[model samples]
Target chain A: MGSTATAKIVALPMVDKHADPEPVETKASAAQMSAAEIQVPEPEPIPTVSLTKVFLGLLGYVTRERMITALLACISIGALFLFWYLGTKYRLEFYIRFKNVPTPYEVYQQLTQVGLSNKYLFNIAMSVRRILLGFMIATIIGVPLGLAIGKYERVRDFFMPVVEIMRPIPAIAWVPMSIMLWPNNEASIVFITFIGAFFPILLNTIHGVHSLDGVLVRAARCLGASEIRLFMNVILPGSLPHIFTGLAVGMGVAWVSLIAAEMISGQFGVGYFTWEAYSLVDYPAIVLGMITIGVLGLACSGIIRMVGVLLMPWLAFAPGGRR
Target chain B: MSMTMTEAETHKGFIDVRDMGVTFGANDNKVVAVDNVSLNVQPGEFVSLIGPSGCGKSTLLSIVAGFVKPTRGEALLDGKAITKPGSDRGVVFQQYSLFPWLSVRKNVEFGLKMAGVEQSKRNTTARALLDLAGLLSFENHYPDQLSGGMKQRIGIVRALATSPQVLLMDEPFGALDTQTRVVMQEILTNIWQQFRISVLFITHDIEESIFLSDRIYVMTARPGRIKAVIKVPLPRPRTAEMTDTPEFMNLVQELKGLIREESLAAMAPEIKDRGLSGFGMKVGPKGVGEIF
Candidate 1:
């Protein structure tokens, strides 16, 4: 045991790159010289790290991650085909109806027709543009207000009751009021979409700001951060993850509400096209529209998640480490 | 021991505490954490406050770092009362307090940035301190990517960045395993010698206190008071080998004995007797024997 311990101590200097040789030698010899004459070694100089190494490591990790995601994608595609085949072969009314439900090939034909048209594509683009513009406008208005509500109890109390009454009223419920209020139908859709997003983002921002760790705030204060610096450096950054959560939820709501808002107004959009297809009994085109909405919603949420990854890398290492 | 107080007084005390105490809660429910403890620290002195949990060693250290204000008494540095924390006093918390959001280099640069030190100077100082802590290779790595020991190393470098006049460490290596703890001690000793800054180290580990401090102050539990101050006569830049020395062992034993006594004293029941419990047995009495 004694010999092993000594060997272990001796082995340490080899692995501990931080251990210096000269003073260790002096300490080793000084024990023989006198009891009081011993001195520990100076610390070894730390080694340098190259940025290229970090970049390579990150690249390797990302490649592995992408490979796993690709495998999952293949598995999902297989599952979808199996479900479709089983539904068609069984001829259960649920399955038979699904089979009669335009086949992927039939849907593809209709989608290609609609998707290829510059006018149709332009209408889809306009709907997307309105949703995004309204969402952006809501974020600009809501985030700061949410922060104020979150940080100050008086602000929360002052606005909370009014917000609560407004919150329960659906975005579509606002279409009549918005149409009456705004000068144009375009503005009304934008207004309804903005209302759809504004509450979730605002409420989330308030919660985010309110939920910030008091210890972290105190830590910043102790580090000599002024009030403005503390808000910018600690509060803003800390609350961002919550803000993003709000944005993602809000965008989903905005996308869903935009179709309603567009239908109420009956303009040239994906919603308008779907209503027109239904009037003409063009069921495949209707299905195509629904699929398009679902895909766009998925894409928008994915963008929010990707933005989260870019903006707050720390969120990736949180205890759950899940999106 | 030769006095450095004269030299220290020329610039005023590095840190001065007068009848410092902290109380939490309110009214009848109030609990005192620290009570009427005063200590003067000079520039370049390594002082360790050793005590058990709830003894308020950390509270005392926090007060000195200006993270907390004492209900009574004032914490002064260079004769100036500390109203709030500044770059002049840097703290290393026990649980590896590196900012998880930042890279090792950025964590170290945080203090420099707060102080408004130019980017070039911040880079130079951050690099030097990381090298000193043996974490230079981990400069760009985030805290989560590093091991516990490596994280603590970055924590030390972060605290050291502003060249703080006093370094306050609250059980800085308390979570590390034994072997890593020893290596960290050696690293801290090396850094202390090179920097020559005053340190207020809080620890419950008696042996760790013996290893790193110029003087160790033992504190009693709950509403802490300084029990005794033991001067560590061991020479500077203490090595792991010194831990096996007769003198070092003797000091460790002494601290352990004192700690054992303090623990028993703190745990002793407020009542001298348990009334009728002692009536049956005559070996002594039911409440006679103490923990020590």
Candidate 2:
């Protein structure tokens, strides 16, 4: 058995020599056979669908689901209007005290009139501008500060106590202090709005930077990444998903605070419009202002979400992100 | 094993670890990870360090890669002491460390990008390496989009991108299934043959060590020290068929015997605490059964 084993070991080189050509010969013959088969006539390619056909297909695809949802929404609105109309017209127990509550028809008339009025447009535009400016200011400061705190333990230790103390105070509570702090009413209102949006952005960004995978950092270091390169390439991009989440939440809070700030201080905004309508006992106009705020908030949040999806195509294409 | 050598003379070995040791913690809590381990890898030679779990094989490799400092002696590459991780010595971890945010091609080109290679050159090098691993089509795919085997292949190609002199692989195929493991081993052998780079591989598999290495270093259990150095006398351009040959089986049996003996020795303390009857018996389907 020992001799046989020795003989096989000695013949291993001969086996390797023979093995090389055997695979090449088989591969060459297989390639030739495949090439010969490729000479046969091919089947006709499937015709491309027309653009109009694709559009119509998409329209059909969306309209079915959307139509059902739209119908359901219309029914819900109709039911709510019917209840309000019956309660207000017949002077029901709850409606007896709610004499200021306008009928659905009156509210609709006010809505159409408000749509044509320049005052309504001015309030919306002013509110949007103030919210945008406040949110931008908050984001610019919050992102960098959060990143620093997350990346450096010394920075975190120094700033964390101050942030923790200030974060939980409501934006409405800031109204008195901001008014005294800022030189003008506009600045104070923006300050309150900034306060509202800042914490969410800061906290989420810190979380994002803190939760970065250690393995990725090590891998980048081994690959010769400098400190700045590591931060820019690994930390920044890795924290993006959380940053986007913060932005969306911040956007919602910005609108809330903008309206609150406008209501408390001298302002021509959606919040002031609602407050003025209430003092004038214009019930239909009050409902109109509420609707306008709702629509504006929805649009702002939607835009933020769209931008987030645009920035992170990878996340958009990930398994759970399927539309 | 030669003790006396002048620092001025050029070393023949690409990586030389001399009496290296690592001790974690301090005073009463001190734990020796590696103890007086010395080894060398000649230029273009493939060497493996195999041992039971917690044998400090990984720590030894880490010291060579410059990620960890040895408390005693030192690890040298090209006769220079390694103090920190550098692109010259590439490491492939058991966990697929490919960045999930980057595409496969970009991950492969990461080291080159860090070295400030021009974009076009990076693209060409990345494409070539991807094509070599038969993953050119997967260049645009993210790490998570690929299978475990494909991710590891990308990891290997990523390490090779900078053209490192020595490749440090720590159980690169340990996470793979058996079939993928075999295929990966073959791919690795092919790449190593072409690159001809010195490699210091750490693994727990005896068969893998024998199959891949020119010399296998078996290490003792924790407080790990080199127990044996066995040479694999197989012919070059090793084929899978060689694994089934009589010579291969004999070498495998011999190595298994050595490993089993060491394993038993490592288990001796536990056996003494539990008693031989409790140590040998294990819960089986029918009832307690003899495990040894």
What are the C-alpha RMSDs, in order, of all predicted structures? 6.9, 8.8
Candidate 2 segments whose C-alpha is farther than 4 A from its true place: A1-99, A316-323, B1-13, B261-292
For model 2, the chain A TM-score is 0.75
- Interface RMSD of candidate 2, in Å, is 11.9
Chain A TM-score for each of the predictions:
0.77, 0.75
- Compute DockQ for each candidate against the true complex: 0.25, 0.26
Write down the worst ten-residue block by lDDT for model 1 chain A: A29-38
Evaluated at residue A239, the lDDT of candidate 1 is 89
Candidate 1 lDDT, A1-323, residue by residue in tens: 24333443564554343433222332332222122212222343332254467668888988999999999999998898677656655644842376456566667888777778897797789888898889999999999899878878999999999999999998989988998999988888999999999999999998898888765666566566787777777777878989999999999999878999877685877787778788888878887888778888899899998998898887666657652
What tens digits encode model 2's per-residue C-alpha lDDT throughout B1-292?
0111233322233999999889999999999999999999988889999888887999998888878889999899989999988888888999898887788999999999999999999998897777666566568978776667678878987988887788899999999777557556656775676677889999888778878889999898888999999999988666566789898888888888877877877787888766555556545655545555
Name the weakest run of 10 consecutive residues (lDDT summed) in model 1 chain B.
B1-10
Can you list the residue pairs that collide in candidate 1? none
Best by DockQ: 2
What is the C-alpha lDDT profile of model 1 across B1-292, one tens digit per residue? 0111234333422888899989999999999999999987777889999987788988988888777889999889988998877777878887775666677898788877887889998887787666555556567877776667677777876777766678888888888877667767766776666567888999989889999999998999788999899999998656667889999999999999989877756654532344223334234434446422
